[model samples]
Each structure stands twice: as structure tokens, then as C-alpha cells.
Target: DVKVTQSSRYLVKRTGEKVFLECVQDMDHENMFWYRQDPGLGLRLIYFSYDVKMKEKGDIPEGYSVSREKKERFSLILESASTNQTSMYLCASSSPTLLSNQPQHFGDGTRLSIL
Candidate 1:
């Protein structure tokens, strides 16, 4: 089974502090993504990497950045934590096959709070 592991299940930080969230996939998937979910906005992709060291910005990249140093690991960085950044962050990985419609495997997610 494809398993995605996130470094933290929950995190709390003070405003202005830099925060790091991590995710690792066991299946050696070629694609990984980071998203943040809010009450009204729903899940919004922040960044994604299709290959090691190759990343693309998603819908919202401001105040956020990502690093994919290894094929199994992806890291999300909150440049400066703020109250508005508090939300549930999700990490997912996917592999493309000859067949269409590959579904992404997701981690349990990290609930972050910026105080």
C-alpha cells in the first residue's frame, strides 16, 4: 500500500516564527503535493513537485515554500507564521501509470495553529 507519512500531526507556533512541515512517501511516487484547507476556501494547493528538486507553485504560494531534496521526502516551509496561516495542512503523493485517473495517497494531515 502506498503510505504517506507527515512529520507532525499537530503544531502550534507563535507569529513571526518560521515553521517547517514534512512529508514522506514510502512508494517512491513521482509526484507530491502540499495543500492547506480552511473552513470556506476548502483545500488549496500550495506547492507540488513532480521530480526531485523540481517544484511548481500552486494556487497560493505567498508566505510558503517547498523543498524536495529526496524522492521520498517533501518539506513545506512557512516563511513567517501568522494567525491567518493556521489551518489543516495535507500532503499527498501520486504515481502515474499507463492507465488514466491515478488517485493520490494522502497523509493524515497536520493541524497547525499560529498564535
Candidate 2:
């Protein structure tokens, strides 16, 4: 079974502090994504990587960045945590095949709070 593991299930950080959220996939997927889920805004994309060391900005990449030094690992960096950034962060991975409907596997997500 494909598994995506997040470094933490819950985290708290002070405003203006830098935060790092880590994710690891065991399925050797080539595509990985980071998203933040909010109450009314829904899930908004943060960043995504197609391969090692390759990343692209997603819908909301202003206060965030991503690192993918290895195929199995992806890290999301919050440059400076803010009160508005508090939300549920999700990490997903998928294997791209010939079909465009590839399903992505997601971690349980990390609920982050910025105080």
C-alpha cells in the first residue's frame, strides 16, 4: 500500500518564526503536492514538484516555499509564520501513468497554529 507520512500531526509556532513541514512517500511517486485547507477557502495549492530538485509555485506561494532534494521526500517551508497562516496542511503524492486520472495519496495532514 502507498503511504505518505507527515512529520507532525499538530504544531504550534509563534508569529514571524520560520516553520518546516516534512513529508515522505513510500510509493516512489514522481509528483508531490502541498496544500493548505481552510474553512471557507477550501484547499489551496501551495507548491508541487514533478521530480527531484524540481518544484513549481502553486496558487498560493507567497509566504511559502518547497524543497524536494530527494524523490521520497518533500518539505514545505513557511518563511515567516503568521496568524493567518494557521490551517491544516496536506501533503500528497501520485504516480503519473498514461491515464490522466491518477489518484493521489495524502497524509493525515498537520494542523498548524500560529500564535
Which numbered prediction scores highest in TM-score against the true structure? 2
Candidates' lDDT values, in order? Answer: 0.94, 0.95
- For residues 1-115, write the lDDT of model 2, one tens digit per residue: 9999999999999999999999999998999999999999889999999999999999999999999999999999999999999999999999975246899899999999999
lDDT of 2 at 2: 95
**TM-score, model 2 to reference:** 0.96
For model 2, where is the 10-residue window of minimal lDDT?
Answer: 96-105
User: TM-score for all predictions?
Assistant: 0.95, 0.96
lDDT computed for candidate 1? 0.94
Off by over 4 Å in 2: 97-99
